[model samples]
Target: MKLKPVRFIFFCCFPLSVLIFLSAVTKKKPVKEALNEPGDGILLIKNTNGPTLGYSNKSGIKILSIENLYFKDLNKNGKLDKYEDWRLPVDERAKDLSSKLSTQQIAGLMLYSAHQAIPVLTGPFGGGTYNGQPFSAGEALASDVTDQQKDFLLKDNLRHVLLTSVQSPEIAARWNNNMQALVEGQGFGIPANNSSDPRHSTNGGVEYTAGAGGKI
Candidate 1:
């Protein structure tokens, strides 16, 4: 099957170290860092739009600034690890991360997060029950996750998550932090690589045109 190259860019565009500010306030989680900006924890680059990626302050990741580029201290060992170092190739970094991951963590990472509905509804398609009860039956926030979601992250050790629908940008960010802290605090501190299915509006968006020289 042919893969859509532009599919990943939906994440890539957001991954850019562009958000200068990141919200770092959580009740149970440690408030390691704080920013006045509206978004979540993300390091800033002077005179640039923002960062290429973001780090969860609750995860204890520190920003390593070398020259002009900024990298994440994912392992939180005070020094920059190989996987977090931008100088290394992605394969090498993946290998480094994989080597440190436990068997269960690997299995969890291998397992794909199925279609998950936030604040699970009551119907059959997007609705689900939390702890064998409807979402409204319990005092759960819109971002409050389901029992099964927790099982996959904690028991299955799955790190690769697939987000289906979200209430809002703020709610989504909060959910990301909550989930990250839950998993990042355990095992080898491997960060969750969250991805999403592309969302497109056919009537509103502009059309794509191929290059004349067969180039990207």
Candidate 2:
């Protein structure tokens, strides 16, 4: 009644294989938990397998947890929307968001704002008023958003902003954060897409027509 070599090896490995499979089936990834309290300004939720999420508590946005991963509830809805889920492809998320926008919101998204300057310059090119007075009147900080900027952001829902100048780098950063916070609290939590003119050298002597190929 001697067992063959192949049968003996199979018998020896059968129980061990079953045990390994059972252990793997029972194992699960541990969920990580983090609490974001009010007044935290901007909080970062670190993820081991996904994107790091940044949300401002002051913006009325909330953190949502799904299968141990955290996402931003940008629209403040309790349920997670496709755009708010980072796991999906960017094109899918964008399509989902586009389907949810209203006519006015879509129109606003298409609008490109005029040139804006941080602290609002006093000159004719990019000048603006703070609380109905010029920036040099000493009524507003250099980082403050001008009244005109606020009107375009809130009333017109304009998200595309063209920036021309800033008082300083620090002031520019502060103004940018302030503007983001303002818009993040608005509809759909859409942040402003700000652009600036080229800050480096320019050749004033060179000019070209729209249809021309080379510089004149």
Candidate 3:
């Protein structure tokens, strides 16, 4: 049987619904507000190991503070579920999440988006359009979301994306943040996993072939 994400309804005077979020990792328990940028989609908490955890505010994801530790609420059910707890085995968490997804979501999970270029273009390789026009037809950033990207993401429900082009590190970072925020407000708040072909170049522990004059 297909499973559905748990959603809640608030009977406030204006009928308000709350989104939940959780920090992927956190340091000591939060005694006071260390970071506060409430309306922005995601919140960042400092990790003891030096990396910050980001969670969306609109997606109903929040950081649960325990005896000084922070946690992520991946399913956004107002509490930290098994899948949200990083301390557990990843396989266990994945199984829990897998059981909560609907059939459509599972189909979406199976789909893989084609090669995409950040700030899509009108070129020969990995070219795309803005709205219906080329990226340069008007002033569009390399990080601007193209029409095809939106269609595949929402209509096709494809979460996996392969990025082929990036203008700079800064542009790529901004694009990633924007993409996460956009999808965070969507159906089940599952984040996209953007990837690219691995470019591996290693010459370590190689032997020289004197006959071919090559390193292997």
> For this target, which candidate reaches the highest TM-score against the unseen true structure?
2
Model 3: per-residue Cα lDDT over 55-123, one tens digit each: 655456566775455676555667777777777898998898888888888898898887776766355
For model 1, state the Cα shift of residue 196 in Å.
Answer: 6.6
Residue-level lDDT tens digits of model 2 in 38-139: 332666777768777766656787677666677878888788999988889999999999999888888888998887777675657567898888877898
Worst 10 residues of 1 by lDDT: 207-216
lDDT values of the candidates? 0.60, 0.74, 0.65
Model 3 CA deviation exceeding 4 Å by range: 1-32, 36-42, 47-51, 56-60, 129-134, 137-139, 198-216
Locate the minimum summed-lDDT window of 10 residues in model 2: 207-216
Per-residue lDDT value at 59 in model 3: 55
Model 3 reaches what TM-score against the true structure? 0.63
Whose lDDT is higher: candidate 1's or candidate 3's?
A: 3
Error of 1 at 197 (Å): 7.4
